[model samples]
Target: MVLERFDAIVFDWDGTLLDSTAAIAGAIRGAAADLGLPDPGPERAAQV
Candidate 1:
């Protein structure tokens, strides 16, 4: 019903509607460490 009423729907949650930089950075760092890789640290991780 909702889809039929609207031709399209958009969601803006990619750091614009909501900021998840810290969480995303942490996940990246954790993944790297899980593989025995060096930690990029907060700075580098944020850049990524």
Candidate 2:
């Protein structure tokens, strides 16, 4: 089979082009800590 190409590609922000994983995870961990829960760590955001 052959491959195809597109004239251009589009992506959404807040995830597609940014590695906000650390920021997101930090927020989650902070929230969890505030609520007396365990910090899931930045890797958890990457999984999501």
Show where candidate 1 strays beyond 4 Å.
1-4
Error of 2 at 6 (Å): 24
Q: Quote the RMSD, in angstroms, for model 2.
A: 7.7
Tens digits of per-residue lDDT for model 2, 1-48:
999999998778666778677777778888889999877777874565
The clash numbers for all candidates, in the given order, read: 0, 0
- lDDT by residue for model 1 (1-48), tens: 354577779999887898888998999999999999999999899887
Task: Please state the error at residue 4 of candidate 2 in Å.
Answer: 32
Whole-structure CA lDDT of model 2: 0.78
Model 1, TM vs. native: 0.76
| TM-score against native, each model | 0.76, 0.53
Residue pairs clashing in model 2 are none
Q: Which ten residues in a row have the lowest lDDT in candidate 1?
A: 1-10
Global Cα RMSD, each model? 3.3, 7.7
